[model samples]
Target chain A: MYQYSNFDHEFVAQRVAQFRAQVARRLDGSLSEEEFKPLRLMNGLYLQLHAYMLRVAIPYGTLNGRQMDQLATIAERWDKDYGHFTTRQNIQFNWPKLEDVPDILQALADVEMHAIQTSGNTIRNVTADHFAGAAADEIADPRPIAELIRQWSTDHPEFQFLPRKFKIAVTGSPHDRAVTQAHDIGLRMTLQDGLRGFEVIVGGGLGRTPMIGKTLSPFVPLEDILPYLEAVVSTYNLLGRRDNKYKARIKITTHEHGIDDIKHRVETKFVKIKPLFTGEDMHILKEIERHFEPPNFKPAKPPVEAISTTSQPPAFRAWLDTNITPHKVPGYAIVSVSLKKPGATPGDASAAQMRALADIARDFGHDELRISNEQNVILPHVHRADLPQVYHALRQADLATANIGLISDIIACPGMDYCALATARSIPVAQQIATRFHALKLEHDIGPLKLKISGCVNACGHHHVGHIGILGLEKAGVESYQITLGGDAGEEAEIGTHAGPGFGADQIVPAIERLILGYLHLRANETESFLEAYRRLGLAPFKALLYPQEKKAA
Target chain B: MSVTPISKVVTANDLRSGEVIYLRFPHSWTPELSKASVITDDDLAQAGLAFAKGQANVVVGAYLSDVVAEIDGPKASHFRDTFRSTGPSNYRHGKQEI
Candidate 1:
């Protein structure tokens, strides 16, 4: 982990002190709610439906065991004894009081963390591929560049108040785990002519209007990448719509201005800003690279034969099949601890669960942990020999669900349950779907399906990119859900196309079960995933199965 | 003939604690929506909101929430208002715990 410098420590301390004073003023009637709203938002405090929600940024989704422990402490001591990990790879503490937020910020600062830019119209947490350095397919670790961007965009005077909140995602591998194509700015590290550069994708996002980003540049030289980003964001800052809040994103700007027009303007701006970056960023990256050096691997093979010979638990076998992935280093496996326990709230970790995970990171995981965008925790470097012990610990904590990419492994936003903007409840619906599927014991047979549920059109759950997407909406003052199919968040990314009418909240889970059951019958074999079946057969068969009664009525 | 408006109640989050609170009477708040006084007229609803606004020292985001007047008390007209009464269905916290 990159340790915070004295300058970084002092900067966060000063910010906390300033926000404490602001909170005091707001409470004393010195600052009106209207005035306090923006200030609170700047510090990542949102006035949610039930209480104050504090969104703390986990920069590039990287954390050490101590930081995880501190987060657990914050959850237990201040807010409710739980935290929600968001699709942006940040953690949100709901049910916090306004008076307690300053104290909470101080606790976060003690651990070199802050809630800064996790909300408001600022460059949010710069996310990276969770398995950045550990994955075998990656060319190089993407965190060094991501950390550099985090430093640059943290209260950058120029980009602080854009037309709307901007998001940036980075991935070093050809396999797009970061969902690079669905970001405001997506950077894919590529090698061209023996020189490393990025394939820049611009103006992709999911909200009221979903769009797949257009290629801004095939490759920009590594040295000039920052200048290129500045040019792109600057061009967007100038031309993005300010009149309509809904249309204020860079995606709309690119849509309205056309990619060619936007590209020409950005390149024109790039020429002017290219000279300002004077290799300081490269030096910072080298310094950051020192912190992310690979862990010394023990030369020991996993006891594969012994485990296979012994009567292993069916649940453990199921867990190994779904949750474990190949590591770049031999004898090591990346463990994805499922936060989506059956019938529980997705992405929520209790204080005890957090503590247990922290202990596991300290003991088994080289003190490094990652929060994946899929709302699960990643033990990035666990030894294969230690899997049984890790699994035992996780089972005790109720974090072992044995479902990684199955139907039960759903990504859901804190909809009307906690979010003020949500029109319907996402947690209950996700629970219903997961519990129902688990009861059926069909998830293992289903294989590699990504289901995402968003409470509203905000798409915070990354519902726009799920293989099967469920969006909750309010129709006729009752909770209604709309389903979409054929969405894929991969190297070849596409926004999901919506299926017909919205279903009642009660009708959605059974409808999804019907779609999946139809998919099984429609598939040539079990190896073909849900997305593959949907693509091969098209929506006609699935729709026919989903609403056979409706077809009969017609 | 004059038409009577739907019933309404003034509610806001307490400034100190973020608990959802309803205006039961002048300068008083209760967690129970049933204890809230309902205004059947638009002018009275506006007046109730203004009265709640004067108590800004203890509250924020004071506004009138639509409700239906029942024999027992005022009931929420929308599911959102119902959420304020029972808290989130996912967990037993806030007003739901009470």
Candidate 2:
């Protein structure tokens, strides 16, 4: 975890104080709603359908036990007893009172966290792979670069009011857990000729219009990343359309002006900015790297035989199979605490659950915690020997769900339930789907499925990248769901293809059931996953299954 | 022939609490949609919205939403408003909690 410097602490505290005064002014009638709206949004406050939502950034999805404890405290004291971890790896308190947001922010700043740049048309939270430093396959920890970007982009004067909100994702592994391809800017850390650099991707986004990012530069040296990124964003700031909010993203800009032209413009800009950076950024990066140094690892053998001989519960074995990921260390494991319990709202963790997780992290997981973009918590450095203890603690908190890459592990946006922009409810549908599948006892059998639901075309759920994507929309005064197939959010990222027509809310769960069941029959073997099968076959088979009545009529 | 006017109600989020509130008769707000003043006349609805918007110190983003007048009160004509009237289906927190 990157420890906040004194300068960082002062900056965050000052911001909180500034926001508190702004809130006071607004409350006292000195600043009108029109004047205060942008200000509030800049500080990550939004008046949603039912209440104000305060989105607090967890920079690069990294935090410690103390920070997590403070988050739990804030949740219990101010907003609802729980918070929603979003796809961007930030946490959103949905029912925050407008008057209490300042206090909430102060609480956040106490733990060296702030909601600054979480919203507004500024560079949002710079997200990296949740398993960045811990994953076995990673070439390097991407957090240092992510932290560097965070430092540069936070309150960057020129980029504050860009054409649209900018998002950046970095991943250190060959496998893309950060969904780098679907961000405004994607940085994949790579080693070439014994020198570290980034494979720079520009203009990938998922919304009304989904586009896989284009490779702007195959490899830009580590030292030149900031300038290169400045070049990209600067080019986007000028070239991105402001005439239409719908087409204002860098994706549309890249689409309209071709990747080559954009690349040329960015290259031109990069040349101008390269010399201006000096080495201050590198110095800061070196200091940041020291803070992220791997924790001292103890020489311990894998607890496979010990656990196997203990007559451990079958549920523990199941959990070990699903929730645990191979860690970089010899006898360590990355335990993903599933927030999506069946019938519960996805990404929501109660204060009690949060505290439990904080404790688990402290006792077993080296005090480091991570929030995955998949809306789960990660105990990045849990020793394999302590797996049983960690599992037991998680079970106590109702966080031990043995469905990591299974069907029940769905990603859903707040949708109409909490989001003002949502046209239909997403949480209920996700809950229903997860519950239905859990009842069937078929999730593990179904195997490695990504079912994501977005309340609307905004695609907050990353529905565009799910193996099975459900997008909810309002049609004829009713909620209608549109399903897509073959979408992937991996090294080979691709936008899902629509499977024709839409289903009513009542029909969606059963429809999904038919689709998955149909897939089981259609797959080449039991080992082949849903996405692999979808790729091997096509949408035609899934379409026939999804809308069987239409197929029968035809 | 005179066309039947669609019933409407003035709605906004409370400035301080951010709870969904509907404008009542004269100059008051209520979280309950049933307690809201259902204006059948378009001009009156606009006026009510304007009035709600003018109460800037108390409310934000005031607008008119369509409603169907029943014997007891006005019911939200749209699902979105219905959600605002009640609360999110996933949780019993906002208006539903009250």
Top of the candidates by lDDT: 2
Fill in the DockQ of model 1. 0.82
Cα-based lDDT for every prediction: 0.90, 0.93
For candidate 1, report its TM-score.
Answer: 0.98
C-alpha lDDT of residue A466 in model 1: 93
- For residues A474-553, what per-residue lDDT tens digits would candidate 1 score against the true structure? 99999999998989889999888788898998899889998999888999997999899888888888888778898899
Model 1: runs farther than 4 Å from truth?
Answer: A301-310, B1-4
Candidate 2 lDDT over B51-73, as tens digits, reads 98789999998999999999999
Chain A TM-score by candidate, in order: 0.98, 0.99
In model 2 chain A, the worst 10-residue window by lDDT is A301-310
RMSD from true fold, candidate 2: 1.1
TM-score of each: 0.98, 0.99
Model 1 chain A worst lDDT run, 10 consecutive residues: A301-310
